[model samples]
Target: MLESFSNININLKFTIENEKNNSISFLDITIKSQNNCFQAGIYRKPTSTDNIVPHDSCHPQVHKTAAIRYFANRTVTYPLDVISKEKEQKWSEGLIQTTNTIGNLLKPKHNNKNDPYKQSGVYQLICPKCDMIYTGQTGRTLNERLKEHFNDFKHIYRKSKYSTQLLGNKHPIGQINEIMDVVYVGNKGSHLNTMEKFYIYKETTKGNQINDKNTVPTNKLFDVVILQ
Candidate 1:
């Protein structure tokens, strides 16, 4: 208590208000300014009955009504970007909740209006020309996984194996514009190989071209890697 008081450079005093029933208690503080001869009074509730003014015989008006009116009329503002982000955060949280509640069958919800990629999950890319599909999984984000495909689409010699095999065939649909649509298959996982294999099997059974032959890679690291 002494340490807290010593940290402050201003002259101040504190008083505690005991709670009644389930209502919460609060502190009433009084401060004296050294810089100017300005006096201020602030409280959550009036500490004394004299602070309240009796106008009507039945009820009384508030004593510090002018201070309340002044603060009420004060202009308040927030950044437009901050407001946009707050709204986006709420939308994302709702999507996360809805995704978790539903099993594998729920269609992929777009993270944004223009983007089909999600923050995390197993996703499938469908061919525009044929009914062929490529299923893949990522522990990171679907955006990161889709980026690898986009990289393959851009390069002549593709770095992503699945991207090359899926897009490099005779009935090739190499461009992102040519691709039909992207859909989330299973939930994101650390070891997504099993889920990817299951979706691949399902799609292959439905007559879709299977690009990946190897389900489990040799000496594969299964841990979810987070990059700082």
Candidate 2:
């Protein structure tokens, strides 16, 4: 099956394996064979960590709420049966999870949002009028970095490549939501830098990114995650 799928697309590679114990996992979800039918639910691998980002981690609100949004969206969007619906509802309601040793629910802790580590990450900013996009990374809050771009555009400053070009082209000024998308979040490190470059390469191949080609070279590894 792997060879067959690999041959279907010369540029792509495929891997196949058999499901075991009537259950199999795929992309954060698990599928189970039940009475000649299939049921799906959230899945977490044994190595998964229950730890979460610190409240004052400086991660954007989007990043903080991503998991909740995903769970809520899945609960509402997936065509789950009655029993699955109950299970999902209970899980989504926070009825479960968050216990220490005695199975008693523990209160979550919070930190002062002012003093914090910079939540570095890769992000994309788009030109509303021309649909052009820029891929970049920063060791700061995404909002902070994006605000600089907006300011540069407002003042016609040469501080940023993307903002200067957007203004020079006489493009319409847009709100942050109109142009920015947070792609990945991490600390200031090589991983964050690599992800930024990878996204730039991805957009460049699509002929949309305004940023220059990144130092990260082309690799076949991305094919595993990318859709054919």
Candidate 3:
């Protein structure tokens, strides 16, 4: 003869409130039967309350309340059935272990090699209000670009009268604003030249008009040329 047999069914539903001032609530219903007798249980977690409590009940039950504030707004449901106490305990332990393993696996891992500033295919903005002119190159280091600019200035000054006259006796034509050096990795050819020209024009214009905030002077005597 069979000693005992049990059947259990569990249903869970929950609501979440993301607002700081609001709350969320949920209801859980459980039904169990052994031999000929049946038992029903109801659980409720109210928004104002910090603990969940089980209530005795029979037949179908309905539980309702405000939402919880401290927990993430999510709901999970599972069914439970058992024929013996040992089986029930084993099933519960297995569920807990599975949930913990999944949670750990989903967590983000950190690595030192990741560079947040390294970007490709885009233009970077430099500060036009700064004291120095920042010259930069794509696909290369800012220091490298600065070195190339100085080399070019030196070579051209000896070969061309225009470069000698413009550069004059200045040892370094412009100081490198290290803080404002931007690498535009995506811009190509004419677009890159235009961007460089724009930066130069803006910085020169702002420097010349540092004292005036009103309309630009009508006289063409301005130090910087405005390229339309």
Candidate 4:
């Protein structure tokens, strides 16, 4: 049973229209027949608090307006009559105007990301005898990853480029503490890829990068940071 299903967020609801109900509410719209024509209008559950990502919050602008975009999209896409459409528009305008109100404070995300030993982010492994360095990211702890690199280099396995490239150049590979350093801490995913690339780019600019060049398109955001 555990393998077959889980009920974490699977909600069950009865949407069947009863004798007293003329409209069916589905998702964000209400649908019903008027005269001889079928019509649909925006719907909001009574429990809706009209809350969204506030403008004053420490988050990306796009993240703040994502809900607003959805509201505008629904207002344009739904078959609401002029009156209902105007009401939704006014509601959306009010919501946007009130977004400047700050709510509970949240600690800056950097507070957590700065912990080097907590794992998951870009790291650098340097050759003991050369200026070259290998930058990489992993979801696991840096200690574990660095140990893996050391073992791979000692065994002459081809799994890691850091191992093969360093030893191939007749360089000595030391234990994790002697050669590895945590560069930036971040969670796993494509975000790590960008963070890893940023460090690699830095190393390459200094003529010390040992990794192959990446083909990911140039990120304008990275350029803005580097130019400063």
Q: Pick the candidate with the highest TM-score.
A: 4
Higher-scoring candidate on TM-score, 1 or 2: 2
Model 3 residue 227 lDDT score = 33
Name model 2 segments beyond 4 Å from true.
1-119, 214-216
What is residue 77's positional error in candidate 2, in angstroms? Answer: 47
Weakest lDDT window of 10 consecutive positions for candidate 2: 101-110
Predicted model with the maximum lDDT: 4
TM-score of each: 0.37, 0.46, 0.24, 0.49
Cα-based lDDT for every prediction = 0.47, 0.68, 0.36, 0.72
What is the lDDT for 17 in model 2? 53
Off by over 4 Å in 4: 1-115, 215-220
Q: Per-residue lDDT of 1-228 in model 1, one digit per residue for the tens?
A: 755775575566544545433234224322334355432223335534222221322343354354334333321221123444455445434433342321222334444554555455567776655656777666666667767776776675576655566557645555443553454533555435555554565565455645565543432112211110
Residue 225 lDDT (model 2):
31
lDDT of 2 at 68: 71
Model 1: residues >4 Å from true position, as ranges?
1-116, 170-193, 214-228
> For every model in order, what is the number of clashing pairs?
0, 0, 5, 0
lDDT of candidate 3 over 88-177, digit per residue (tens): 444434433342321222222223353313422222223233333333335444445445545666776443221233355343444545
Q: Cα deviation of 177 in candidate 3 (Å)?
A: 6.8
Model with the higher lDDT, candidate 1 or 3: 1
State the displacement of the C-alpha of residue 175, model 3, in Å, after optimal TM-score superposition: 8.8
**Residue clash pairs of candidate 2:** none
lDDT (C-alpha) at residue 50 in model 1: 21
